[model samples]
Target: MKSMRAMNVSQPRRIRIANGQGFWGDSVDAPVRLVEEGPLDYLTLDYLAEVTMSILQKQKRRDPARGYATDFVQLIDRILPSLRTKGIKVVANAGGVNPSACRQALVEVAEEHQARGLKIGTVTGDDILDRLEELIASGVGFENMDDGRPITDVLDRIVSANVYIDSFAIAEALARGADIVISGRTTDPGLVLSPLIAEYGWKQDQWSLLAAGTVGGHVVECGAQCTGGNFSRWWEVDGWDRLGYPVLEFAENGEFIVTKHDGTGGLVSVDTVSEQLLYEMGNPKAYLTPDCVVDFTSIQLAQDGKDRVRVSGIRGGEATGTFKVSIAYLEGYKATGQLTVSGPDAVAKAKVCADALWGRLERAGFTYEKTITELVGLDSCHGQIPGPPPDVHEVVLRVGVKDGDRAKVDRFGKELAPLVTSGPPGITGFAGGRPKATEVLGYWPSLIPKDRIVTHVDVEEVQ
Candidate 1:
């Protein structure tokens, strides 16, 4: 408890940032607990994923005010009093696929107490959908990085093409009286960087200083993953229920102190921090971003006593000449069907059943690039003991495939139900409905020259 008490105090004007939640549906209790349990200057909530963008895009197509994160508004309603009372600010990308509606919803929540009229701010003008043609005319071809295809191939087919905007736009929103700042596609590090820029007034191109703070933001962006979620020495982390959420004590000299909530569910040991340090990181030195190229190799983490690791000695230089674009498109159709194979030659029968299904599909003039069949009692995610268990009560065989032909794919879904009554015994169909024929969205990550795109910062008052 002594170590816990040490983290619960104030640092006097130092910006303390606590990431209350990692993604949507992580833990509703976690954010409320972070607010009530600790003294936080700013709370950053990240609720986004590749699939989330697709979901939100669908919502936007239906209603203009329905695309944003409404759950954030409801959660904010519960915490408005606490935030207003403690003078705590908030920055979150729960705007998911829409930032404007998010800001408006927050203003409505603030009207309950009339808390200075709740000056909500939105940072937009980053979206480039309307200007893609102009960008191409200017010789900016956003070639598909994965398939080497040009942007023209799927130009109209593209649903969402957003550049990961930097923190300056968000920081500008904060500087101009935003109680809560909501954004659409700002980078994860930008969430943390915006708070510091707003609080400390750092210049845009102060590369060294900006790089250092960006490093701090990147370190703690993934919630407990940075603290101890995937530590190498998993058994060593104690008291996971109270494992701490990351804390950033910002300094004006381009440095910050990284700690956590006093009594949270994780640990921040050097090993835990290190494990997160390498997760999906490409280059140690010259790590690229929209703002600066940070050098992770230059970072130094000292166990500045229990539960606190002080990081310093980071260096950085010029950013890359281009911005990476995240584009999603229709890939193909995928179907997964599961059934049990048991009785005598259960395993062999399961294989035969799979082959028969494929054979029938082929005879029906349907084809796919790949077909996968796995016996659940044998695969790792579901397998146990590795041997036949008792009487082999059931051996579930899961089958899946991906194909470009939609008609053929639809035919495959119709085949699953028949197998229950026709082929192998005990072939219980989990659900009665046919498998879906939804479009498969694939990520197309590529870069465009920085000179071609102009990122602007705009802030507007709520109605």
Candidate 2:
């Protein structure tokens, strides 16, 4: 196979890339369907969430070979043959806390299919849990970005720490002839942007082009979200069950169109695409990434026919000298329990049930660091919206507690089952059994100088 770097300098008029996953728990069949349903040059999968590193770390602690997203491996197992046969490549951040383990799994999958001559790349050096103390000793404070607290406050409690790497590393993997690039803690947009960089031979100083790719990536990063899954106007969308994942038809000049396969479900219009563009958006004028800083205000969107939106005129600036770091630590323990309240005055009955549950816990010497009681249907969210709430037939009484004490959280769980028989009539819906206390992981976002972190890319061919 020809190396990605060795491809002709004269690029194609257009290339098609699609993202079939938004996060780790998104539909399992989406990526497989994306490969089989339509033509694509590259398929990207995003499996890491903000707190996903901690979860994968816990798994790694339990089993050495089990830190990556297993779902991705399964998906690859199902679609590897199609990907190779159709001349499609894959780029994904499903490596979680361990890209090496993920690459090993993929190699095994390739071997299982007796598939040879396939190159798999693993991007590493993002994880910094082991280097936290060393970095702190070297004057890297690792202060909490939100509150400006020093790392010494919870230094020992840190579980996972990873810096967000850039698309350049992924592009390098492709340049080395990697058919599939699995990365650790890559920025969501990097997955889509890397392909454009590799295909178009985009230069590092090309801020405008980089920004354009980043904006395009942000639009389709969440799979079908931009394709009408989370649109504001739900009544206009159709084919919910088979909604098409988003596709980016890219030009060498940094222009692109957001669309999906024909005959597939979902809508990809200006509104749907616009909704996704605003997702997780901070400042409309400046969106930061490892490669460049994008000006969202400069972006132009045009309706380019049915199920297609042309995106252009994106402007960007230089990236910061620092990289954002995601750290997770042991926060405490928390457990939540809910019960249904029916019949007349259901809202009143639900509120009463919440109070009773907390009162019982308080009386039992089970004080917590914090506690919350919510009449779910009434005001769990938005907290009692202005004006009178209409009468409801039923409401769910949900209560949760968080504390440093595990025993206290465990005892809180015991108090919920008693509510079914002891407090308020019409209490039910505990068929899944008692709620158990689970460890709460707290997020700590910080920044590290770009010079302090080094990314390594290793590509190995399947034997």
Candidate 3:
């Protein structure tokens, strides 16, 4: 458990890190476009979130070889030639709950494309699903971070639990000559930070440098966000059809310029970069990660050129002794159904339809833990902030219910179709059959001692 700074070594003068994929379901062509359009030292992709782990677990339960993000393999197949020619390495957390399977799939794709010399690395030990019970038995309280509830509250229904690891293991894989690194549940910034560590031999104790690298990663982690893809001033952005992905021109001293490939469409200015810096931000002074505690307030941004922003002045502190764990468990069942009501007094009719449906369900002894009724064309999003509802031509009536009892939620689904013929005169748009009850997975955020978890890296050549 040496400090990251303690293992540091010297590296090149500069490195270019580009991020193509933001989340699990981002644009599939973005990764290929990133490799084809530019020169980069590394391409990072982030593909996991809290709810994503549950979905992947269910997929793995149904089929052994299906849990990881299959899109990564398809993208690799499309970009293998460019990757070899450009010598651009890939670092991604597309492993979801199964890094080994993800690495094997990548290896298979490389071999299929005759990319014989490609080396793939797998980082495991983030998953703690099978170890939850053992840890709890060993006096690991595993209490919920928000509610302080113990792990035993939903132990029987838990599906997946993974620790948010850092960049060390990923760096280790790259140090062993891995061309691609597949990891399970590493912190989003770690995917980008690990390359800095692997290439520059950055020591673990170099808090300020690690912090600056993390700030760079956070800015571009969402791919095009800092490049004006999700900017508030959308009209200022050019080329709506092909927004450019992000590229970080990182220096050995931890100063980097955030930009995109040449001739690409997107605005990379101080405003755009500042907007992404506030995304998912908690305390500006103490943005915690497994590698270091980065102080967002210390960051400085400036427009370097037409589509580049220079990011500097980042400061960081030593790392904490614990790791945040994301755990998901079965909460209940939920179903939602919607009907469009048209013509004059549509709002009134929609409200009437919703009441009728709920009345029928309640009369039949079906009580839901939670219920919601929304007028889609009106106050669904703004609520009372929109003020008095306007006289609209049509409003979609959406009703949803959630409960631990599956049968109750299912019964609520069946009650929606009857409203078309029996309850409302202007009701229509119910062609998709009855709304099916789906399992509602609840998220449990917790923390665990760093010593309790162990992470390792394995590298294999495509044969």
Candidate 4:
């Protein structure tokens, strides 16, 4: 048994982590390809973002089990046979707003693959919404990190409040006979890190070791971000459509080989890995998490071969008591439209374009918290951001405003479509049936004590 699992008895072995899904709407083919393509000990998918929590919360309110990523359950049913055949485990934050419900859904999927039963695990307790009042009364001010105001200032408008938990809980679930681990609002890197811990049985205080694993997780958590999907030099990348999903071939000693599936597309150049290293990273020297503070610079990525990069040499530090806070508020609805100006004086034509649209709206009694009009293809970007004004070929007259009045927003939406038929000749990219009015959900930030919440792990049979 030990010989078959060389990683278990010795100096540790490479454990591969494949990030199949980048965000909620990413391709299902990604994960399917990853599993069929190579040997992966753990498969990871991260589906939650700050604003995503609000969206999921709204769905949960409508139906108890409906909020979690339904696609994940569907994906499970498709991949369960492949998973058992390959002996590959999966970890994901697709539980979104409801971990227990997602767990239940996975068990149903497992039951369908009756040849081999599957044990699904869920990690809860990050949510702190119900404890808001008691936490505030205890002199713990969960103030808005941005505005510094107390929680009461926007008490009624709050939607979802969850802490970014460490990956150790995920590791624990895997240790406790769980074939799959589902969670809500875990750190993006946690999905990857937990698998490393589960495979190696790393203790909690293995700070330097855990930090190294965390760095690897960050690299692959966004699917193709490190795999050349979002690279700025898209031209430089060889094959994007077949671009390989990322994999972290982890080792028990906190080192790993960073590579993609063999014979798959995508390049693992040093520059590509470097770009992913910088995403959502605050302090490279101290990339803080509930697990440990990761020192990204100490890490090194060496090109081992084609589609393979060796990742090693990371350091770690202590973690802070507080976790990152995510809060949201109501931003109301906004409507925006753009028109191209392409006459002799395109800039002048652009301003004329703006005036004509707003002139009528103003006459119709339209006022909002803000109104903006800009010319694209010319001076849209960096427009009075730091300074202003660059004269060029054509300007796109972009106008937008937000207000409590839904009618005003509806009117603005109606105004954009007419501009295409009546305004400039070069307008495009608007294939959708007209830009409909949509309400934008705002975000808020605050903190809660670690003890204020508790995480529960539950398992059940599928009906």
Span of 10 residues, lowest total lDDT, candidate 1: 454-463
Which candidate number would show the highest TM-score if scored against the true structure? 2
User: lDDT by residue for model 3 over 313-428, one digit each (tens)?
Assistant: 99999999999999999999999989999977898889889889888888988888999999998889988674665768999999999999998888889999998998768789
Scanning candidate 2 in windows of ten residues, the lowest lDDT window is 1-10
- What's the residue-level lDDT of 361 in candidate 1? 85
Model 1 pairs whose backbones collide: 240-265, 242-264, 242-265, 243-264, 243-265, 243-266, 244-266
CA RMSD per model (angstroms): 4.0, 3.5, 5.1, 3.4
Instruction: List candidate 4 segments past 4 Å from native.
Output: 1-12, 339-348, 379-397, 418-434, 461-463
Give the Å shift of residue 348 in candidate 1. 3.8
- How would the candidate models be sorted by lDDT, starting from the highest? 3, 2, 4, 1
Off by over 4 Å in 1: 1-13, 239-243, 340-349, 380-395, 426-429, 451-463
For residues 254-276, could you state the per-residue lDDT of candidate 4 as single tens digits? 87777888778887878889889
Q: What clash pairs does model 3 have?
A: 3-204, 4-203, 4-204, 4-205, 5-203, 5-204, 5-205, 8-203, 9-201
Instruction: Note the Cα lDDT for every prediction shown.
Output: 0.76, 0.90, 0.90, 0.79
lDDT value, residue 171 of candidate 1: 91
**Cα displacement (Å) at residue 328, model 1:** 1.6
**What is candidate 4's TM-score against the reference?**
0.90
How well is each residue in 37-105 modelled by candidate 2, as lDDT tens digits?
999999999999977889999999999898899999999999989998999999999888888888889
Model 4: ten consecutive residues of lowest lDDT: 426-435
Give one digit per residue, the lDDT tens place, for model 1 in 1-463.
Answer: 8876666554445788888777776666666777888788888888877667767877888998877777788889888888878888888888767777777777777766566656676776545666778877988778988789888787767777777777888898889878788888778887888888888887877877778878877877788887777787778788787677788777777666777777666777677777777877986887888888898998888877777877778788877777777877777778777776776767777777788888888888877876677877766276466666545556787877777777767778777667777786756645858876667788878887766665555455444
Better of 1 and 4 by TM-score: 4
